[model samples]
Target: MYKLFVAGALAAGALAAQLTQVSNYNNSAKAKPGMQDITFRRPWWVYVPDAVKSDALVVAIHSCQSSAQKYFQNSKIPWKQGSDRKGYVSVWPSSTTECWDVSSRASLSHDGGGDSNAIANMIKYAVGQYKIDPKKVYVTGGSSGGMMSNVMAATYPELISAVSLYSGVPAGCFVSASGASAAWNNSCSGGQSTATAQKWGDVVRNMYPGYNGTRPKMQFWHGSVDSTLSPNNYQEEVKQWTNVFEVSQTPTESKKDTPEKNYRTDDYGPNVEAIWAVGVGHSVPSHLDASEAWFGL
Candidate 1:
């Protein structure tokens, strides 16, 4: 079973070069005698130049109800290849289950929020097992996975240097949409009128309480046409981050000569950036070119 799972995951990676999987038993002797072992998938591509060691690592989280294979296969294409003929390692781990435990739903709230811990452990392992630069670690995700990325950044600020999210809500954010139950507090409660905006405000405030003082470099992207998660939420996220980082907002428009279409960037702080894609759906845009342009791999 484990071998099959690994083989399937690797096959998916071959298509996008953004995924890998490993199986390991829970060796904590203090636990039960025979708990089910874990088989997790993660991004394994390292964008490096030649044989030189990487100066940074990117840990990507996938969307809810989505597997690592699907997310990796759908991301910007250039990321699958490395930068300047070099590559930096990118990691993506499957959630404990098919859906992340972002809400209080009985079916989602299992694994004791080990998703973030699992990521931290993976980084630790990578540092010891591979040549990785500790100061340059970054995280990103989309949709539900995007929410998890936010949670990880908030919960483990010391472990991450920067974060980027797509069509996602903030950490610990829950909403009572048409078909969803309202279990966890909505991250958008104390913000703008739109659900997306409110959630963004709440997430930034809750996660970066000392934002007025100091915060990490951050970036966010959302499609204006995305109704599943709402593009307005990205605006609120940018507003909160800019306020926290004490940066001026200057909207700059640019056109990508690709399927991603036109987009704009808001420069918040010296290093903070937020983008709104004009016509994209809930999916990650192939135009942003994360693998090649953003991370330079």
Candidate 2:
């Protein structure tokens, strides 16, 4: 059975939202049963609050090997009946495979075109089905899903207003030779010869285009202790997009009661900002906290 959560604010006419699962496999013939053909499977969980008036939606993407269900569970946002209400909708789309389709060095190809198109379709579906405010639509994800969120911001800037990335590298992070001139050239080659790796890194960076001015707001969060993906990539992401947005770095200090120490750096621009969550591990912080402080929710 599916899970449902509605807050008292929704009942009080402050907000109205609900959670449901959407099956995208039937939408395309490319989706085959079993393993006969490499078909694309698109399944997502949606959260809508009663307070939502129109055109305000948030798309939450999941990390590698993570499902939309788990993302919803990990999220501190209230998803059950009668909880704190925010008049908005959240949609989480699952990747057909364990990860996103950022494996290609050319054109950002995935298992099928559906991976990219499915998101657009989902947006269209939500806008039509609900009275949504298109200007306020935002996207956020972690790890592989975070990479996908960057791809979304780069490719479909018009549809999204802002993006929040948790422990996510740039889109070309997985590409063969994508970080030559930067400090990560040696590591980009995976311990291969620095000279050879640098060549590949340069090629990767050149081939892929950085975010132009016509992009949405952006936010990045990474754990300083995270060894999975080097923290340098996070810095590169900030540098590459410096021209498009006005950046700001704010160091977070420890509170009297909290033992864990963290620093937050925010890059502000016309409609975008990137927040680097330092000293933490590879995980998205509490949405209630991030929403109130960083996201301005």
Which candidate wins on lDDT?
Answer: 2
User: Please, what are the lDDT tens digits per residue for candidate 1 over residues 29-142?
Assistant: 221123222322233333333444566777767766766666566636233344324556766566646655454321122222244445666666665555777776777777
Candidate 2: tens digits of C-alpha lDDT, residues 235-288: 555644543343433322322212134565553443444555556666646344
Cα error, candidate 2, residue 87 (Å): 1.6
TM-score of 1: 0.66
Candidate number achieving the greatest TM-score relative to the actual structure: 2
> Which residues of candidate 2, in runs, are more than 4 Å off?
1-18, 24-41, 50-54, 75-84, 105-114, 176-213, 246-261, 268-272, 292-296
Q: Can you tell me which runs of candidate 1 are displaced by over 4 Å?
A: 1-20, 24-53, 75-78, 83-85, 104-113, 175-214, 248-261, 286-297
CA RMSD, predictions in order: 8.6, 8.4
- lDDT of model 1 at position 34: 37
